[model samples]
Target: MAVNQTQSSLVIPDNNASVSGNPGPWTEPTFTLAAKVRVGVTCCFFLIASCSNVAVLCSISGKRCKSHLRVLILSLSVADLLVTFLVMPLDSLWNVMVQWYAGELSCKVLNFGKLFAMYSAALVLVVISLDRHWAILYPLSFTSAGQRNRIMLWTAWITSLLLASPQLFLFRLRTAPGVNFTQCATHGSFTQHWQETAYNMFTFCTLFVTPLVVMIVCYTRILWEIGKQMKHKNELARSKNDLISKARLKTLKMTLVIVASFMVCWTPYYLLGLWYWFQPEMINQTPEYLNHSLFLFGLLHTCTDPLVYGLYTPSFKEDLRSWIRRISSILSRRAKNSKQLAISELNIKDLTSMEGPTSTAVTMQSVF
Candidate 1:
């Protein structure tokens, strides 16, 4: 999710604030070349994330039985799709416009939508990690996995909604004095600076810190369970245990890679946000380009999720390949048809030209 740190660069400094004087004649952000590049990059990531996640949805939906794995994949894809459709385009458009043109109502709703999508993306992965932990550690749990998965899905979505709801109350259209630039931010939401910082700290904890800890803990337990099983196996089962250990380790390694990438992508932005919330002066101290770069780097996580998950998932990878071939064939046929149609038009024009000459020759012969 985007933080106020991003808007700090765009926001005009308050004369009443305790920061450096005037930062001199505040200049509002414009549709600069950097903004244009951001829009283009965001668009590219949006398209990639949209297609991959949609493919994941379609592939899972087409299956005859909805296993827990498929269900988890569907949930992850849905979460990514939410980010692809909601966050990427909105952020890009906001950058291009350099201000919130939509009304205050739209601002509140979009802000809510953004945070909701962000929560869903992170929380669903937490759900998946928990599911994996349960399946591996307690294979014969009291509750059926299907039932448990449904419950977790409901909880993830409901929790995301509840957490993001505050955005509706916190964000509004704020216009600078004597300027037409109005932006959607939490500028006037809190009376005290500490209150605003407190709210941001709460969001940061819920959105990033808690989910991350849950996922890492879940996987850590899973890996321990795996190693324990290997250690306790009988000598007679050593050969089979080796195979199982190798396979499990390979899968878990990939899972850890996903967690690592998630951290790498989001950690910088969140850390920067944490710093800015405490040290408001750093808002001016941080470069605008650095903020943009980190925000986009965070957005890259949305694009990476599907690719990583799909590439490793045999079924999803096959579905993606089949889809690529299908799209390629369709385009090929359309292009071939267009070429043929053009040839026919050229031939018709040539015949029409010849018709005039032939008519003139016939007329001259008749005259003779």
Candidate 2:
């Protein structure tokens, strides 16, 4: 029998290209160009907004502002910033330009970073929603702080790392058959097909669907509590305006914004992915439109995270204002001090002149 080189386990064919030994079906170039432009712009927006949020959060000091929620917000902001700065930009560049300029190592790093940030963000949002729900529903029972919250945060980090590990193994950069450019994708082989399927299912369910359900339930209960509180006609204005009640209202509003932003940012991507999962044939038939649409939807998450930060975090705004005010005060004080020194020097010179010959001779001798 002839040597069966094609049947070897070490060799794998790129399924992304056409069967005629060509690179691709070569869909409309316009779609790819538009998708690239959109992703690039969105990534830039994400980077700017997330970096601003991180700066704002870092400026906050003192004890009153350092709650569990604040800490969680900071973590989320860091995660968002990482995704914006590290993952989305690279991914956008690759997809939009239709080339992976980065090497294999970068592809792996991007895959890991993207999955890590995404899962961490999703988990934190769920935790925030639950924290708000508990604070609203059972205020006395959920007094976690300091060590407890730290422990929980550590746990979240570990969980996120574990959840995102699979992506590192599953994704790789590979040259498409007969093509010069490499693309990032799951390793497609007979042995890895089932693994990819399982990975996709797990990622979709845990990172998107499950947390989304939990958020919906938690927010619904929170809204119900707020409505109940609002309807109490006999409730004293003093109690309504109490610090705890006001804080609760603020928490509710923040939670609403978080959930809304999460849904708005991720829903399109989830829907697009679901369509692809259920109908893989669409990839070959309408690769340009479907892929571009999916890419655009995915970019939305990176862009909307900063909006969530701005809407939800009052302390972020306060800290920004405080920094501006502090700088202004410092500048003002320095200017005043300089003016006072100038006035004092002028007065001293006038006094020296008034003291006549003795002081004038002494001043002239010191100057010489």
Candidate 3:
């Protein structure tokens, strides 16, 4: 979901220069600064970790790496990275130091990036859940990996572009009356309202609610499948242990991890949005403290994405281990070389002592 910076009920004045209409108080600068700093640091950490994992996963070139789910995971990483690198940094800066100081171009770019990333990520998650559900419930009838991957890729691109169209078309920079800086927001008009409503409904339904329902249902069915497998194993006396069974177990674990993380990360943001939707006037009447609190909670999703990848991807852990080993090896070699050089100097001093005619002679030779 796109983050809304303005209070819901606060209306902008019609005249650019007049401050006649009293719309509620603006958010406090200090509180906003703290919120931005906290969010920025969190997003930076997630971005670094997630991008590192993505690089590692993409570098793998074997049969195990060529799964449909892995492709979806990569797509998710890219989408989250885009949000972290392209959108959140500028958003934090705008929130803390310069409320929309970067100008019209920045405003447009940030808006588009935020909405596009969010929509794409949501779409990928939904696709992943559906794929898992089909594979587990109807193994024989499941779609080919190539077909699913192609369709999801197309959907991600098209949905993101479509979702972001509103920002590109409706967003503009307008001077807030009596305020020195310009604000980037939806233009206030009937057309803008209908357009934003349509965008919100699309996002709320397709991106948030639909995916959430699908994940819950899919995971529930998966649990049922696992139960059936376990029961069959218990009852059968001559069942063969098979490679397929092992692979299925591994896939189930990974799916559980992904679904759990996605739900935990995204639930707060969607709940907050729903809350705001139900109580439109709360934004205007609520104190800055409450609004800022909601904003921070909403941003937690961006901060938790990398942790999700690390929890699910075995390749990510292996790559991290390899990185640590390389660093350790480098340090060990440097230390060994330093020790060898120190021993060589000592040996040279010992030889000079043995060849000296007197102690003073030996000390002088060593000094030279």
Candidate 4:
């Protein structure tokens, strides 16, 4: 969440440009060092998020009966895919182009997509935290966990779409008065300065604050529950439910890690956005590369979620190993086949050369 939610967050509001007698041309976006850095870093994140999230989906997808945990993780993976496929690519392309070239329709659609992707990821994490909270506090009450989780996941996705739908209306192609530069932003859409600020703040609350509070509360209670469980460890050690209790605790720890990564990765970027909202002048004071870096840093959360998931998932690791071995086996067979073919070709060449010499000698003798 940047000062401007859409338009690549590159178009900082300038109140005086139209007020001036001679409005200068908008300085075009260049593929400078800042952009180069964004491209490189975002590409790395894209690959990581894409591969890791897809792997998570695949590893859990084949299970006949998914627990609420798996369902929430699957939903999270899908949300990460949205960020990986939509936000990362769009940001890279928009930065490289430096302006809106994909026309007004594309501008609206892509802006909507960016917001939707972000909202989905944040909301899914909220769902995951809430699910864990419910499971920990009321294990017996989770009679239909799958059905309940499905409903929550649906609600999260629909809410994400609804929250992000305004971007289509709020953003459009805004061209400079005398310049050919057009940006996908909310410049003309908002009549007053405060309206844009209100919108940004609203987005900030939805994208960061609300979700943060929910997760913090959920995880805090979970920690308290863990502490209580530790107090009864000796009793649980003698009970038949000991193994089940330990497994649940391990899963809770893993989910907390995923939540922690999301918070750690995005906290700084959103905090910067909050500061910029209060002090609009920071946009100018801040170096270009710093802005780019901060946004890319926030994107790191998308990659980290999958890494956390994969780390906790033993089945995913086993599947990965199997995949690696299968690929290596296929490569080795191809290499061996190629070597054999080369040897056979060499033998054919030798036979052809020897036949040529023998035929030449026979012709010479006939001529004599």
Best by TM-score: 4
Q: What's the CA RMSD for each of the models?
A: 5.2, 9.1, 5.9, 4.9
lDDT pick, better of 1 and 2: 1
Candidate 4 TM-score over all chains jointly: 0.90
Q: lDDT scores for all predictions?
A: 0.77, 0.62, 0.62, 0.79
Model 1 spans > 4 angstroms off: 13-25, 64-66, 233-254, 343-368
Q: Per-residue CA lDDT of candidate 3, range 108-144, in tens?
A: 7777777777677777767777777777777665448
Q: Write the per-residue lDDT of candidate 2 for residues 31-103, one digit (tens) a residue.
A: 2455655676666666666667566457443444546766767776776676667556655555455555677
lDDT of 4: 0.79
- Residue 327 shift from truth in candidate 3, angstroms: 1.9
Record all residue pairs in model 2 with backbone atoms less than 3 Å apart, i.e. clashing.
none
Instruction: Give the number of colliding residue pairs in candidate 2.
Output: 0
Which candidate's lDDT is highest? 4
| Model 2: ten consecutive residues of lowest lDDT | 1-10
What clash pairs does model 4 have? none
Runs with alpha carbons beyond 4 Å of true place in candidate 3: 6-33, 43-52, 55-63, 141-143, 187-198, 228-242, 284-315, 331-368
Candidate 1 lDDT by residue in tens digits, 97-154:
7888889999999889989999998888888778777767776662588889889999
